[model samples]
Target: MRFRPLRSTPTSSPTLAMVAEPPADMRAVVIDRTGPPEVLHEASSPVPRPVMTELLVRVVAAGINPIDAKTRSGKGLSQAIAGYPAVLGFDFSGVVVQSPYESHPFPAGTEVFGMLPFPRTGGSYAEYAVVPTLSVARKPTSLSHVEAAGVPLAALTAWGLVVETAHAHEGQRMLIHAGSGGVGHFAVQLANYFGAHVTATGSARNASWLRELGATTVIDYTSTRFEDVVADVDVVIDLVGNVHSDTGTRSLGVIRPGGLYIVVPTHSFPGYAEAAAEAGVRTTGYRVVPDGSALATVGRLLDSGAIQVFVDRVFDLAEAADAHALLEEGHTRGKIVLRVSDD
Candidate 1:
């Protein structure tokens, strides 16, 4: 799908009259109960109102993440679901239709993208979403809403892992597993951008692409064990926990003594901390929280072409189930996004 580019970031939009108020109801992808991807269905729901520094947005697209699928399948944030027929989404990109106030910087029609407060309010799956102001930022002008939609949660997580957690910098050596995934891909780029020598593990097909994204070494996990070829890294960002292939445990062997091991999927291996301690490595689990400031900074990097977000596929909103299904296949190079509406 083609998209109309946003004019610029932090602009005083003149199109405020076009979006004075939202409609009474809106289309949404809701799950009657947590089960599987097939449970996601289209339904009409009331338009949520923006209260207390919130913005009502006309959703142009929504990004599908691993957590969305997990929560849909009765894991991840599923335990926190308040009620049935629940909307499930976190990342979104669109235009503001209702501002916090008349003088708010983000007047109606200003383009933006960010994450929703899932569990608290997993409402980004709808046509219009009420988002807290601090949880969103202006959409990168260089990207379409679909691309912008794929950013927020995944990129923020990567930023936190590579920049905040690992403190990636020159003279550092980092190993990232599942290097082609939504967060892993960004982690690879950010680690490299910060001058870390990055070694990544992905499939053979993604090896060259991962290299192009700044992976100094791309280990094809299919043929060889990453622990065999890589060792003594300053940090190990394991997106693939032991759930699939004992990846988290195997990663402990590759990190240098006292180096950090960051587990993105915390529950994938609950005993990981104990294992890492035995291996003489520091370990911690990381979870992403909404941060508009961090997202805005990522936007600048994207606009400057310092980094890029890969959208592996796009599905219409009604095909949300199909999107989630594809996401679970675990081979997606980057992100899968739902085309919720036009820009």
Candidate 2:
């Protein structure tokens, strides 16, 4: 509910002269109260300005994730931290229009993509987003805005679990749930790239696609119980938390002694640790944070085709409610993105 001026005093960048003044008000998908996807509606709000160490970006595309919907429904982290009349989006790819601090690495007009601060106000579901400089990295040239928008949050979750937290390496057996979903697709690819033998769970229809994303084995969760067939796994990345089934607790049985069960859900049921202890395995809940350096590494990998981003569908910004509805169906093959503006 605070507003800052869109245009600050000109910085040293020569491109500043070419940067146009932002509009007084811009279209944003805002949630005034918690409910279903219909609660998210397009509204007009003041164009947010960059403050110290922040970059004001003109968003070209934004990525939709389950958290956005959970937040809108007042069921997740957003319910605790988000103020009413808040914009609900985290991942974005855009061009920087203004940088307010001298130490900011990106100049005016830099094409950048990254996740905003999680469990906080990102306001990325808008025409313009003001983000901290350290949270963004240069966009990958090989990807379009929509493709780049899909990478940050999902890729970061995968990277944080496999590379940073679990330290999965060659010859390790890693199991990823929801392998065809946004984060799962990225986790499968990144784990394989890091030399781990990856197993992923999804429907039979997604088996070949999951394999192409580096899933060595794709378990059809609809027909098979993962714990029954999969055992002695070094790491289990549980994106499908303990919501419908005992996924978190059952995953403990598959992990080998001293192996890790990284829960990726924002919230979990009680006694996960006790179950892990009973199985002589370790358990930790993982949350992705904003890291420009890590995102830069991801960008390099994306540009080199070492990792690929899969976009299942693209919706216009006005259709943001529809996007959330589709994501809630919980069976998207990859990521769904909202095209905010043209490049």
Candidate 3:
């Protein structure tokens, strides 16, 4: 099946006076009951139409994140906002199919990629998605649909912490945990790009690769305790959370006084702030927001090769359960994406 674009000519008068009938149904991954990866299965649903300031997107590829798996298992933020039989996914690259407004920045057939509003039903794991114009941006011309799809959510999260929250700058010391994972890798690069001295923690095997991504110091978490070897750091971006023995709390021991520790966890872990308070440091839990403008700036970085997206694997849409299983393992080197269609 192929999705064709809709085109419109400029006119002073409104072209679409009434809502158009969307497709009867479209293929997607739907969860009837939250449980395990088995709960995520391929199904069909009515295609969503562009309403008000929205645009209907023909999704070419969808990116997989740890949150997708958590939500599938009834443990993530989406549990509260998503109804049963919900389509689970957030990041996607696709073409604009129907535009409801003339003032929409992208016209019909414009290729775009973005992370949909998180903790909500994005329905990106489908052939079609309805997204607000403010949440979409033109895909980076230099990246394939698969690559662009791998970016949005993870990249934006990294950008939010490093640039927006931390305000990391030249000569500042920044430490990032799980430096080889999706968001960690990007945070390392972005912090480095902003001229901070970068330190990262990962397996010994990924030490060289993390260094290549701009980490001046790569600590093998298995062989050395990062808190023991690294100190007086300005920022600590903790992606590991409390998974491996109170990583969030232990990270507080490494930051200098007045430094910031940003926690990127789907669920809140206790004692993060208390530990930081004792250490005379700041702590914050960050959730990524949909920002088309910030994503566009990231697209420019991708186009210029200042930053690179590492797609660890790509799964077919039919194998979304398998993708979820892999992501749940929690050791992917980079992003895992689902190829929805050929661009």
Best by TM-score: 1
Error of 2 at 303 (Å): 0.3
* Count of clashing pairs, candidate 2: 0
Tell me the tens digit of each residue's lDDT in model 3 across 246-322: 77877888888899999887554577778788889999999887899999999999999999999999999999999
Residue pairs with clashing backbones, model 3 = none
Evaluated against the true structure, the overall lDDT of model 1 is: 0.91
lDDT of every model, 2 decimals = 0.91, 0.88, 0.87
- The clash tally of candidate 3 reads 0
Per-residue lDDT value at 10 in model 2: 67
lDDT of 2 by residue, 1-343 (tens): 9998698676565544226788899998888888999988889988986666778899999999888888788787664664668888899999988887434578788899997764455568999998888889999999999999999999988889889997989999999988899999999999999999999999998999999989889999999999888899999999987878888888988898999988887666477778788889988988788898999999999999999999999999999999999999888988999999988
Least well predicted 10-residue stretch by lDDT in candidate 2: 10-19
Which residues of candidate 1, in runs, are more than 4 Å off?
A: 1-18
| True-vs-predicted CA distance for residue 22, candidate 2, Å | 1.1
Residue 127 miss distance in model 2 (angstroms) = 0.2
Kindly indicate the candidate among 1 and 2 with the higher TM-score: 1
Write candidate 1's Cα lDDT for 224-343 as tens digits: 998888989999999988887799888899899999999988589888888999999999999897999999999999999999999999999999999999999898989999999877
| lDDT of model number 2 | 0.88
